[model samples]
Target: MNRCRNWRAAAAIAVAVSSWTGASALSQHKHVSDEELLNLLKDAAPASVFAGATVLNMAPDGTMKVVREGNNGWTCMDPSGTDPMCADAGGMEWGKAYMTKGPAPQRLGFIYMLRGDNGASNTDPYATGETPDNNWIKTGSHVMIVGAEAKSMIQSYPRSPKADPTKPYVMWAGTPYEHLMLPVK
Candidate 1:
């Protein structure tokens, strides 16, 4: 039973990594629900982690508006064209920086993007296509686990800011806001 459970988790991780890494082979994937996203948070961390967090909804136009408030200091986002993610206050700061293309801030933030729904292009920061990355090589599904400190901790990766299709890369690089591009698979 344990082995079976492990296998399932591994498989789930594989799919998640593929989905996040710009592989849109699973373009027919279903949209993730709020409850499922919350459950995914619980699965990723402890419920106490989100005791007082802020939830934001990121529109396709790159608009991030506040949805609600939590007791925890953490912040979560319901991003269009990708998986739901939760981040620390520092992560939120990094997000603001990313959105405004402002100076880098060393907030030491982290992000959890799991149980993905493919529509984002790995190359373009905001491609709304169902199968976003037409140049993906892996052709699988996955998710992203990122953080500023994780850049050095992990093997590294960077996102392409233009039409240049890129493979799995770091969330925000070149700035102190850089994060790890941890593909779940």
Candidate 2:
């Protein structure tokens, strides 16, 4: 049953991924001071995660530049002015796959968004705004579980397009990029 749903969801997934702006392709439209960028760290992840996480900033044309080097394997950045997050190595791999429209990696990927997200279409990975049919949801402080492992965990939570943003649910459910969204706030 899930296989059938996954197959049907592929076309939509393809459409969504084409418009998604990933970490590497994050747009920096306006002039932002380094201090502001660095300050975003506080809300991006827990103090422990950000303390040793590498900091990255994207240029106006979507070029990624490293701002701070850290020993831990995690990376922290604000993909857009509104969305700040921290991702471990596995999460980074999952993101790369999402950007390239490839298969999810086998390992589990974790991400922290303590500050909260602006909003996104629950059914479409890259729908920038709300449409008549697209389910747009803005989740407050949450952590994401991604990659192939996340697919297996979907059956344990609600997969509704109209997911409750404050609960544990599957975002982009039925798609290759589907993942677990556990709200923390």
Candidate 3:
């Protein structure tokens, strides 16, 4: 009789432990909606309008500030803030269009872009063709903050280089275009 009671008690504890573990996993993978993400950005950062662009103000939190020129392109503030980063032969590939959009609720990761007109080609005249994978922000498992249009561009872009004849442009922040990736608690 004592053996039977001990067995039942162990079974109950096992069930409770299993339930708690499942709940914790579910919370970790919780999907964040687009609107919810935007609200999170607004609440976490001080936003401001700059020259027809809505700049999501990132505090002096180790990374530099980046600005979007609508969907046209993106530019970074010079250390002095007087002149814009140059669109050299390798133009900025990650523009405002690539940073704002949040990932679909079903997706696990998000991407952000630096602004430029050179499409996605590294050899293009205005190519700032750096991939999101190379960006400092995409290094870890932190939540990514991108502009709405930029997010859409990344989601729509072809995943494989051979799949599409045209090379999709890549964008990087912090070289000339600075973007931030903050850890989400």
Best by lDDT: 2
Best by TM-score: 2
List where candidate 1 sits over 4 angstroms from the true fold: 1-46, 57-68, 117-119, 126-178
Indicate whether candidate 2 or candidate 3 has the larger lDDT: 2
The TM-score values for the models, in the order shown, are 0.50, 0.83, 0.18
lDDT, residue 117, model 2: 79
Steric clashes per prediction: 16, 0, 24
What order do candidates take by TM-score, descending?
2, 1, 3
- lDDT, residue 136, candidate 2: 80
The Cα error of candidate 3 at residue 145, in Å, is 15
| Tens digit of per-residue lDDT, candidate 1, span 63-113 | 334445565666554443345556655555555555455654554666555
Whole-model lDDT values for every prediction: 0.44, 0.71, 0.26
- The stretch of ten residues in a row with the least summed lDDT in candidate 1 is 133-142
Candidate 3's TM-score reads 0.18
